[model samples]
Target chain A: MAKVPVQFTLNGSEKAEFIDSGTTLLHALRDKIGDTSPKGGCHQGTCGACSVIVDGELRLSCLTLAETCNGATITTTSGLAEGGVLHPLQRAFLDTFATQCGFCTPGMIMAAKVLLDHTPNPSREDVVEALSGNICRCTGYEPIIQAVLTAARGNSQNAA
Target chain B: MAIRRGRGVAAINYPTGMNLGGDPTQALVHSTPTGNFMVTLSSVDLGQGMKQIMAQICAETIGVPTDCVVVDTADTDTGPHCMGTFASRGTHRAGNAVIQAAKEARQVMLEVAAEELEVNASDLETDGQGNILVKGAPQKSISIFDVALSAHFKRGRSISGRGMFLIPRSYPEKETGAMKPSTCYAHACTVAEVEVDDETGEVTVLTVKNVFEIGRALNPKMVEQQLVGGSWMGISHALYETTEPYYPNRDHGGTDFNQYLMPGPGDLAETEIIVLERPSADGPYGAKGPGEMCANPQIPAVANAVFDAVGVRVDTLPITPERILRALKAQAN
Candidate 1:
């Protein structure tokens, strides 16, 4: 297969890589760029472990082709920290003990980030609906939901 | 058809560790030159907080701060022997080994402090804040760091300890086949409420309330995490999960996550948990294994709840809607 050239902004930096026609964005980010925070729980989109933000929209990296995201901006869990400071969602997850095995943590954080970006203060049921796609076998969806709500409250408090 | 609501309860007594062939685990504790401790083991954590709990055990046994201990596990070449992590034996078996090892290392640590303070080893006590002091003497104290430095450079002593824990296997008698199979038993009970549709044969779990009596909770937060997550798995196993949906004839089997169904986040039930501490004689700090038993009682409780809701007994792995419908049809006939 002929390698296709792709360029995209990752974590606020420009990155260029060559990938095959059907190579997934997950493969490009992990294998090419060496950012391995997004876990591959399932190659299929059902698990939601490879979730990422593509141009401010939540997209499953496993299902999105790398070539299609040539000029788009992407954000992952690796980019959530800035200058030794963790994001509010990351801080909430840690304080709330929302992770167990942590295989699904990055995806869960990304999904929560998208939800909070859209809805600054989400109800409990809204959090559930937003995170319905992700599968966490360890936490039973309780602490993760709590973490998102906690982050939302913190964000509102900071805004206030 | 209307939805019928009913509740059911189940209680279970679970044995800690496997009794077959003498289940064993080992630990090695040693102090660094900086007074920090390292616990080496071949057991794996599997994200159950094994490393954290082991560090806590080592810290408590050695009378040191928890942050001073680092648990390095699953290194076959350098770490000690372990019988793997199963049978809910990690905490009960491996924890005891870590305690014994830490005790021996603590003995040497206190001895070093005793020599530094010009006091008998018996008269020395650890303050659990990185200091060893003469008993009842406020001023006669030395930091663990200085003691460790003295042991390494001045006295030329290597502070290390090794420990192993094994439950002696008992053979069954020839006549009655009776034998003591476990060192300790953990108990749990669960009450499950369900709403079943009489016509559609659909079952929805409303709530699951449970009480677990482990020997002791070394880490209460981790214990709660396990119980909550395990109950969710129990509810899934009761109604949702199955690789072989049509068993006995393996023509159709699930090959992926989609086919192998599990309860989604929306399918969760309201879970309430109450934990009781009844310390065991042989447990580490009276702590029993709560790994596998947290998921057991909910299985039976959900099954009994299904029976209560629709008045049908489905004794299958997963009480599927098709099975419930079949049982209802059989009852109608």
Candidate 2:
């Protein structure tokens, strides 16, 4: 297979990589750009472990073509932190013990970030719906929901 | 199309560690030059918080803060021997090994502190706050950091220890096929409530309440994680999951997550867990294994709940809508 060139902004940094013609964004990001935070739980896009934000919309990177994402601004779990400060979702995950095996944490956090960005004061049901796409075998989904709720409450308090 | 509600309960006693040719695990503990402890083992964590719990056990045994201890595992070349991480043996077997290793390393740490304080090793006591103080006088004390510095630069002694734990093998009688399978046992009981739709033959688990008697909760949060997640797995196995829809025919097995059904977060039922600690005599810090047992009783409990709901028995796993419908049809006939 012939290799193709693709360029995109990843986690605020401009990264250009050469990939196979049919390479997925997940493969491009992990293998080509070396940003391995996006885990590939299922290449079939069933498990949301490869979730990433492309142009402000959540897309399963494993199912997305890298060439289609040209000039797109991508956000991942690695981009959530700034200047050595953890994102509210990240901090809440640690504080609430939302992670265990942690393979699903990146995608779960990314999904929660999208939810909080749109609905800053989400309810417990909202958190559950947002994270339902991601599969976490270790946490039983309760702690992750609690962490999302905690993050939303923290964000609301900060605004107040 | 009416929904019938019913409840069922189950109790189980799960073995902690298998007695297969003397289940054994080894650990190596050594103090760094800065007085921090490193525990080395080949045991894998498997997301069960093995590393974190091992660090806690090592810190407690060495009388040091947990933050000062680091657990490095699963490097067979550098790490010590382990009998794998299955059969719920990581906490019971590897934990005891880590405790033994930490004790020996703690002995050397105290000896070094004793030399600096000009007191006998027997008279020295660790304050659990990085200080080694005399038994009678707390004023005369040496920091573990200073003790490590002296042991490394001045005393020229290496503070290290190796430990291994082995369970005695119990052989089965040839005719009777009976033996002591494990050293310690963890018990649990689960009460599962479900609503069954007679028309659709769909079972919706309403709630799962359970009590576990795990010898001790080394880390309550980790134990809770296992129990909660394990119960979810049990629910999945009871209703949604099946690799072979038609067993003995390898034609249509699920190849991925899409085909293999699992209960999503939205499908989760209300779960309540109560942990009971009955400390074991031989366990490390009286901790037994709660890894695999947390998923056991819920399988039967769910199966029984389905039987109670519609008064029809579905003997096979993953009490699917089809199975329930078939059983109801057979009952009607």
Q: How many clashes (backbone N, Cα, C below 3 Å) per candidate? A: 0, 0
lDDT by residue (tens digit), candidate 1, B1-333: 889998999999999999888888899999999999999999899888999999999999999999999999957777799998888899999999999999899999888888888989999888999998888995889999999999999998777788899998989999999999998999999999999998888889999999999989999999998999889998988998888888887867888788888887788899999999999999999999998999889989998999999899989979888999999999999
lDDT of 2: 0.91
> What shift in Å separates residue B107 of candidate 2 from its native position after superposition?
1.2
Judge the docking of candidate 1 as incorrect, acceptable, medium or high: medium
- The TM-score obtained for chain B by all candidates, in the order given, is 0.98, 0.97
For model 1, the stretches where C-alpha displacement exceeds 4 angstroms are none
**Candidate 2 C-alpha lDDT tens digits along B154-231:** 999888889899998999999999998988999999999999999999999999999999998999988988998888
Clashes by residue pair, model 2: none
